[model samples]
Target: MSSAPLSPVALFWRCCLWLILLLALPAQAQFTLGQRATDQAATPHVQARLVVQAPDGIAAGQPLTLGLLLTHQPQWHTYWKNAGDSGLPTELDWDVPPGLEAGEIAWPVPQQIRVGDLLNYGYEGQILLPVPMTVGPDFTPDADGTVRIGLHARWLVCRVECIPEDVQLQVQLPVAQSHGAFAAAFADAQARAPAVSSALTGQFEVAPDGQHVTLQVQGLPAPAQGQELAFYPEAADTFRHAAVLGRDWQQRWDGAVWHATLPLSDMRGATPAALEVVLGLPVAGSSVAEQPPAAAWRIAAPVQGQWQAAQLAEISPALAAALAANQANQTNPTTTAPPASGGSNARSGSWLMALAGGLIGGLLLNLMPCVFPVLAIKLLGFARHGSDMRAQRLGGLAYTLGTVVSFAALGALLLALRAAGEQLGWGFQLQNPMVIVALAVLFTVLGLNLAGVFEFGQMLPSGIASLHLRHPVADAFLSGVLAVAVASPCTAPFMGASLGFAVALPAAQALAIFAALGLGMALPYLLLSWAPGLLRWLPRPGPWMATFRCAMAFPMLATVVWLTWVLGQQTGVDGVAALLALLLALSALIWALTLQGRTRWLLGAVLAALLGWLLPTLAPYLRELPPQEASAASSAPGTALWQPWSPEQQTQLLAEGRPVFVDYTAAWCVTCQFNKRTTLSDPAVLQAFTLRGVQLLRADWTRQDPRITAALEQLGRSGVPVYVLLAPGKAPVVLTELIRPDDVLQALAGI
Candidate 1:
């Protein structure tokens, strides 16, 4: 009947059209379902659907189970009832028939979801929230023998960033019969819901100072007696959700009763007459493949202490205005508590002070160990251009341009990310293991190049190589960029306060401060270029230049060593070994590329394969590596002079009337290491700390620690190498980033 046999292309097009039509049919059906009981709402991070438990239609005078199912994309989660430190719980507003009633959601045990410095209670993966719906005897079926249920549901989904989504969903179910597709899900939800405990009795007493709450419970189950139990409070702003739990001093089970002392939130809004809490215990044995379920018991304990209003810390007007403006601009702002600023001595002061501080800080940054290696390269560059005054001046300007532009760009990125709710600060790049590894590899190549292992220009095409030789300005500019990259990890004396204040400033002002910092760093080199008299002091370009260039390579190599050590601190010894292997392979590849003929090609291919293998091997380490616990030696445990730091621990120690000194440092920070090896390690300083009964705490920022970040913010600092001395009933003394033994001794004496 057809006119002719279709061509292959025509036949393919016909099949594609049919496939599109088939796919479009389901989409059309779904649009109709959007107005019915089986409606589903999908978003980038989550999918929501409504289901009924009864396979048959609703029966009069019987209660039926209804469920709102939420399936999250991997690593994304929706909040629970309390929402802990920073999230909003899911909500459902139902429009039911006059005779039908809906009960509260039977919530399942929530998982502790930690995001940066905040700890949230939430659900991940798939969860079914079951609600009991009573069908009254007076209820009647619609004209079509079906009941229509309408729901307006809203939820906030979050991974690292949060997005609020809502849907108006409706479903039509048969009056007498329903599909039992979701019966098992409803049953599972019921099983996971926390039961009201009858055996356990509890009472809570607030500390007189209003800093902590102690809960005492009698009659524990045998399985949960000594096992680690999680306590989730039903009310917000009662306890510090981010405080580290499970420590013996915090929570413990004695012979007859369990006792737990939890810190009170600094922003605790009110005192409740009774504290309702869910105490959850892990299942005796659970497979990881399945959802690790918990057995939870709800307790409503009577309060036993007087209530006091939380003391609000004073903040600078600029910071307050900035925070207010930022909050006002957000359509859906996070409810995470602001960083505690009670002890902060950070003063924004006038704009002039911030600019001056940034300038002086950048100038002093040249003297830091982090910048020393790059300065050596600059020294070599200066020597090479000594004879050509015009070229030298041009090179200086190019370098300055590069430095200022790089600083501005970095500052802008930092500000933008923070605005988007990233918990980041100065030198945040070095916190990433990938950045550290990249720096290590970069320094290795630079060292090899300087040592005459290979020439960069020689590796390029003839024209590009000639251009590279002619345009030394590009090299000078890149050198400036590299200097800023390395120098950023060190927060020079005045830099901490300036950078801390800059974060709260407007984008324009913040960027200006960053540019000022770069300009100050470049000033010395710019001066040397313009002042021919200063250039004359340097030895003329000669045979010594070759030796000096080679000597500079060692400093670069030293930088590589430091970078390697920093990576080790972040990802452990295996990461260090992997990095070293990759570096060796890369060096071999570079050397092979420089060779001639088939041998070069053959060796390069082999090394490239080696690199390809080594590259993927590092991915496992890159994913959130667990922070290593500071060892006894690290905390000076032998002499009992130093211990690891935590905000709760610091508060407890201070509450106990002990002076506390905190050393906020990181492995990547050169100045921190210098201080650790020098003044901080001095015997007299240690003796003074011990003699004065001062508790020493080391807040290691080797890994990206939100708690440490928050603590630093409290002290008005944005980087490591922050020293603070605290004594009861006295203001917290904010010590400088670089401290001397005398400074420590005097601070202790004053305390």
Candidate 2:
């Protein structure tokens, strides 16, 4: 009894402790070593608050001051805009009345604060940030002769782990005949603010080849010795983990303005939108009030270069050919360097890697749950003929060859379609309702066979079954066909790269890779057959064999179910029903083949063949009921926000300044669904998103959605469950397909 009570208490304390720690964590970053934020309230840290100087409202031409006040509890502090290495700088969002113009933040030069080995520039005790604003020439005063301004401010306050905060503020002040009581204090603060020259400007241009970024700055002072140059992006998403690469300071034609070329290194891509580049100096005789134009500058315009090592070779040969033809069509084209041959290695490497990748991919494909039942059927057949090692070996080899040929045929067909301008990929076949229906019927028939509703040996016209099974070449061909059918849903990890390469590579290389994959898949079964001793472990054929065979039908039935669902998604309920009817008909045809005599079998085969040929042809004309779409929890089913996948959504989200979380997922993908259930669906992560007002956009590829496919291509991913988060004013960070709760939280926080 005592222990039981103690257990609950312990559990409660554990939960409370975890919640406290989680809540205490800095949203923008992890608590790293030697990092600490200043404590204000009895903790020697300061609290940063955002406030504006508007009372009710103000008139045009009224000099307005916006203040970001940092109230230290006592002795603690916070950093300025250029928080050296690992501290937060103050930034704000201001919205004023129409015709009102505002200048940049008048940041006061801050003290150099040292915490461990990191150098941070900030304020301690207490500090106030001021911004000057005024109305346009054509302006009117309100009835109360006042103006109101709204501001959204973000700043990093440190005590241990830098804690970032977002605060909303609105202040109203009357248009006065004289200065208010706090006006002089604000003026004194303004005098201490850094003086950033209005003429100073910086422009960034990345090399076309993407190897370097050159920052061109105008009207900037020469740096003093030992002055460390730094840049803060006005936009947070511009770069990550950036450092100065190279700086070249030269005098521009404009008097006294130096053109400084600062090269950035280890940029890791774009800078975060939250920051602006601030070039700091250790020059003597500069006060906190005199650090503006000479101290910090905003990037006049942001620039990014397109240079991915992997993408250099993805240049379309078709595009190149088109360009060449256009040039040749002209009467006199300017001479240019011969087309570089560097692409040859890229093409060849892609092809060989694709082949090798396909082989490895095939081996992994064997592990998919979707393909397991079909393989089991093949192995069971082998077990039945354990004594005939040669027959087993031949059957296995034949299967491998069959798979290879089928893959080659499929690859050739896909390439042909591509040449004809059909946008497609490896799994594109599954998008056709007729194909889905056909596959469904075929599997159902196989299921019926395994269920033992018919005896093929007795019903056949004596010689046919013997001829079909006995001929090694025919067996091998059939095995190949079966392997291709079973390998569809099982996309191994490397298959994406291989398939993408195959699509872009020469026809012969693509075919070769496809064939290699088939061979790899079939290798295991062939080896098993070669080593007959492995079959000795199987139980002898009896009642149990019948039970096992029947049991195997369920997996096929499951496949049928999945195909039917896919059909519904692609076309509609009508399509699914049609598929179901066709499956029933197929079962009847198989049952007919099991009738006692050869005549019945022949007739059944004829009917089955005709139906098989005709149903697919008829599928196109069938009308389908639209599938039901998923909706957000609060939304009514029909009126929910379930938009089809589109690049437009991404653009719109960014434009609206709303944080977005995109889940690239599909219906037929089991792993994707599993991830959704176990990780994405976690309540803690969902609540965090909901509370933070993060928009959840799902791109469903359940059926082939072209836009979603294009998005996948953009990301260099060929499959579903690709997660991405775009935060307001932050660079988009991609999350792994297999998500973790902590990972989701961190990404959302970062954004």
Candidate 3:
């Protein structure tokens, strides 16, 4: 300032000298590793902070603790040392003055988080990583009596996507002779750090084939009364965590203690000396039911199964002895594991029980509405045979063959569909709209035949009748077929359990069960044929037989009407119209067959052609319409109080602490209708439901619904009239197939 400013040439020379000196400075100096506190962006998802976290002054030879804290956005996580299926663990490069020693990081227990199909081990939210350092006499304190450390860190933060991050952090601390300000915080961090558990001392070793690691612990007690155990591995890429734990996916829990075999992965490069895992045990606590006390263990797993030699690396001798003593106190000598999947895992029904149940159920079908039409045919034929045991037995045998073959075929189709991954069950054939429509058409024709529209046995030429649809054998066979078709939807007493067991069994076993059911249905008729005395109960065939036969046609027509309505339910109004039109066209052709000569043949051909063309068009249109409102959904003043059932609604009612009574019904199930009219709709039953505050839910499988199918599976059932009573926080009580008034009342009283 005293002299004049320098000339341009002199200024340029001075600037060049200053630039040279700046360039000569060390890179560390440029990085400035002397700051007391610093914040750096580790990644887009994470922010890192390095703090001295030390006492105001440090003793020359005393140990000091610091923290490398990382705060991440929600859902973003940083990997643990061994990052399961993927990701890299965070690492730090420390540059400090001479004579300063740094210890290994004390890692906290990491959580197992699954991403898509892969499992990852990492920490979410904020974590303060504790780093211990010791000062030696050779370590020089700065002129300001400060201690400094230069830290370079690399980490990865991930959510659905990952981001790599690095930070050059410098932290400076003042030398102090006393303890640190955050001594309690440091101690807490140390406590949270993972250490080998002595709670249950057990050996961990690889399988003999080296394909898996087996962890067998005999001393670990059941977590508390209502608690379960959780397993977590500590090493990175060492095990197939996701594939090994939970699901029916190779995990098995034995009763004595937990024995799990974890399949090894080839991704882990080398075999480490030890394996680390964490076990979460249930302990009593005031909060919730109990607190889960999680402990980590470092196990010395050798190359092979010298299980007794490997010990828990972090346990004390006293704790190990306590675990051994606890295990010895139990009386159970062996362990038992639960069965695998729901398919074959369930206990199977005994063959004798299934056979007996099917027989009884089939016999009961005679009393049901659907079987009434067939019953009329059977009784008429019985009178026609009149005490001739030999003739009756032959007819009975033919009928039995037809019935058994149909049942066998149904069973075969069920097994085939199951193998093809279709989630169908008993009565699954009815779930298809085409099957429903076809059944309707067949019933319609059967009704017309009963009404005398066309006589197969009486009117057809004897040559044609003997080998085709008109022979006595054909008549008996058709009668049996009709019986089976009508009887299928009605799942009688004990039938649900037996059929459920049968469907889950092998194809041959399942078919045998179906055959038994057919035999049961035919038993009464077969007995009447074999023993002549039973026919004496009825009057001899006479003029009254014709009147009775005509009268029986009404029931067949009644069934046809019901089928028409069912068709409407399945395919709206147009489907019903199409079916009725087809019936009319077919009837005209059959009527033409009764007329004389060429005229009859020509008229019949025209009608047949019309039907052949019309049937194809109808078949194409047999699509399932949208589900309509169920009668149960509405609580109109004159109607009984009930609600439409769904899996969600059933679950919701149960969760609300309201007792629920579910009626798994279908329109095609005649027994279900009978029960609704006689028992469920009775005043006493209604009063019981009202008194018990029962939420009545009706699941109508009149049409296809996968939810209903799934629900049936849960109940171990395959057909309808399955009445389940659910009480608040209690196991469901399944009532008998036939819902009598007293059954409902008694079930409600128990609830």
Once model 3 is optimally superposed onto the true structure by TM-score, how far is the C-alpha of residue 649 displaced, in angstroms? Answer: 2.8
Task: Report lDDT per candidate.
Answer: 0.73, 0.56, 0.63
* Local accuracy of candidate 1 as per-residue lDDT tens digits, 1-751: 1122121112222323333532243234334323234468765577889888865568776658788899999998998889998888999899898789899988888888878877888899999988888888888878898888888788878887665566667788887776688878988888888777578899999877678889998877777788767778888777788885324238888876888988887667667889889888866565211342467778899988766756443344433443433222211111122332423232233445778878988899999987897887687778876689998998889889888998888999999988987777788898877678767777777777667776654454445434435566776776678788888888888787777767877999889999989998999999999889888889888789878777877998898888988887776777778778877977898899878889989988998777666565544443224333532234232325667787768867866789898888888887778888889888888888888888988887776666788777655567777887877765556667778888777777776
- The residue pairs found clashing in candidate 3 are 57-175, 57-176, 58-175, 58-176, 82-236
Q: Estimate each model's TM-score.
A: 0.65, 0.48, 0.51
- What are the candidates' C-alpha RMSDs? 15.0, 24.7, 30.6
lDDT of 3 by residue, 1-751 (tens): 1222221112222323332432232222222322223434344466777655556356665667767778889988888777777778889878788878777777765666678887777778777677888877888878997767778777878877565556778767667545465566567666656555456555566777666777765544444222444456766556666673346224345665666677765444456656656655423342111222454334333344422222222234433333332222111101112222333332242555566777777777677776787776787788877877777898888778877877777778877987887677777777655556555655655555556665553333445434422356655775677677767776666677667667766788778888888888888888887777787887898888767766776887787787776666555677778768866876687688767779988998898788766665554335524333432332122244777787657655665788998888776666677677788778888888888899888887776566787777655567776787877644456677776788777767766
Angstrom error of the Cα, residue 478, model 1: value is: 1.8
Q: Model 1 — TM-score against the truth?
A: 0.65
Q: What does the lDDT read for residue 84 in candidate 2?
A: 58
Question: Over all chains combined, what TM-score does candidate 2 have?
Answer: 0.48
Q: How far is 359's C-alpha from truth in model 2 (Å)?
A: 3.3
- CA displacement after TM-score superposition, residue 545 of candidate 3 (Å): 4.0
